[model samples]
Target: MEPVMPKDPEVHSAPAAVEMSEAAAANEEDPAHPETMAFCPTGWLPHGHRCFKLVSSDRWGSVEENCAALDGDLAGAETMDDYNDLHTLAQFFGHTYYWIGGFYFQGVWRWIDGSRFIYNNWHSQNSASSYPCIALRGAGGWVNTNCGYSYPAICVKRAC
Candidate 1:
């Protein structure tokens, strides 16, 4: 199924309901620590306290499973910085759309890593039941689409 795009492509503002955590805010303000780079494997980008990498395209479930095999899960964006970093990384790797860790479950959207799903930049709020998986658009904004669709994905693990 084709992902739905917002009427105004430039409307990519995140909802103001969520506040960035103190730790995340601090990390965003500070540059990556030198030691953090050593923790990330070659090809993985080190940011804040985590390492992120873009994986090959596949169905959401398969992509998630592939991430798990690498000792991580699909990436989650707890802050606007985190979201933008993920988007930038995917774009850098030339992927127009890629899966993240967001999913609608039991009426609530949750990150696969169990982080709170507070921050969002949805292009349009589609019915969660029909489009349960979340993918990030390289141009900007998020899209809700079927989990079965194949797309590249970002995987994140702690840099420690």
Candidate 2:
């Protein structure tokens, strides 16, 4: 079945625009802090001091590896804002189903990046052992599915 679009107000209300710093606009890299990025990289969306991107379809594991290569991990929704932002990003990109950082591990749900799994937007309480990975439905809410299933994925990393 096709997922439904979210009715959440926050999802509809556009997120605040993030402006690039002067250094970032100049494309200057800081020699003293090579790790610091003034802005998100090309093709990435900047929001609240973080950068996010959607990658092409792949299995959950493969998608995570792809995120790692970009110096990030599968995206996680630790708060309502995070969830709304991710949902909006997917909707904007015209994706129906996309992988997030959630997974069933050690008999508990956890974000791949080791973030606390406190907040959630679960579509249902059904979490069968066979469905170990979490995917965000562009329509709304999160779903547990087989890890081997292929889907586009959202990757996120801190923006310095």
Candidate 3:
């Protein structure tokens, strides 16, 4: 697949076209419902079971503290689709380190969340060997090491 790059950094993805017409009519009727927010699916952190976590908009603690401003330990990127959702949300926010599924255990690139990782790793890329957490770089369109790298990160919460 071709690289999916957004023209505008803070743009909300266009909801699927098939549902647009139906949604337009429904939108007029229920204006303030939770479903109405095009950008936020559930008004919950994940955004329609999509797994979106905001970092550092909270009081006390570091950016990790805000990791769960929307949810707690139960939060996680449930699938590749959900991780992709968080990735897009990171773009909208212009965040530095939107954490997703990647970790190094016994010298292997294992995904923390069991989703099939959807990223292209080049030879020069050195994340799994040196990073505790992974963050995607929009400019290079690659994931990189973030071990001990202090930056804002996104977290995920499971639906209860």
Worst 10 residues of 2 by lDDT: 7-16
- Return the candidate ranking by TM-score, descending: 1, 2, 3
Q: For residues 81-153, write the lDDT of model 3, one tens digit per residue.
A: 5445655665665644344445556755555544444544421355454444455543323354545544444
Candidate 3 regions with alpha-carbon error over 4 angstroms = 1-46, 57-80, 113-124, 139-141
**lDDT (C-alpha) at residue 24 in model 1:** 39
TM-score of 2: 0.74
What C-alpha lDDT does candidate 1 achieve relative to the native structure?
0.72
lDDT agreement with native, every candidate: 0.72, 0.75, 0.42
TM-scores of all predicted structures? 0.75, 0.74, 0.50
Q: Which stretches of model 1 miss by more than 4 angstroms?
A: 1-38
Question: Pairing residues by index, what is the TM-score of model 3?
Answer: 0.50
Q: How high is the lDDT of residue 106 in model 3?
A: 70
Error of 2 at 11 (Å): 22
Of candidates 3 and 1, the better by TM-score: 1
Please write out the lDDT profile of model 2 over residues 51-158, one tens digit for every residue: 877776778999899999989989999999889989887877665678899998888889997765899899864444768788898889988887876677889988
* Model 3 CA lDDT for position 149: 47
Clashing residue pairs in candidate 3, if any? 46-52, 75-156, 75-157, 75-158, 76-156, 76-157
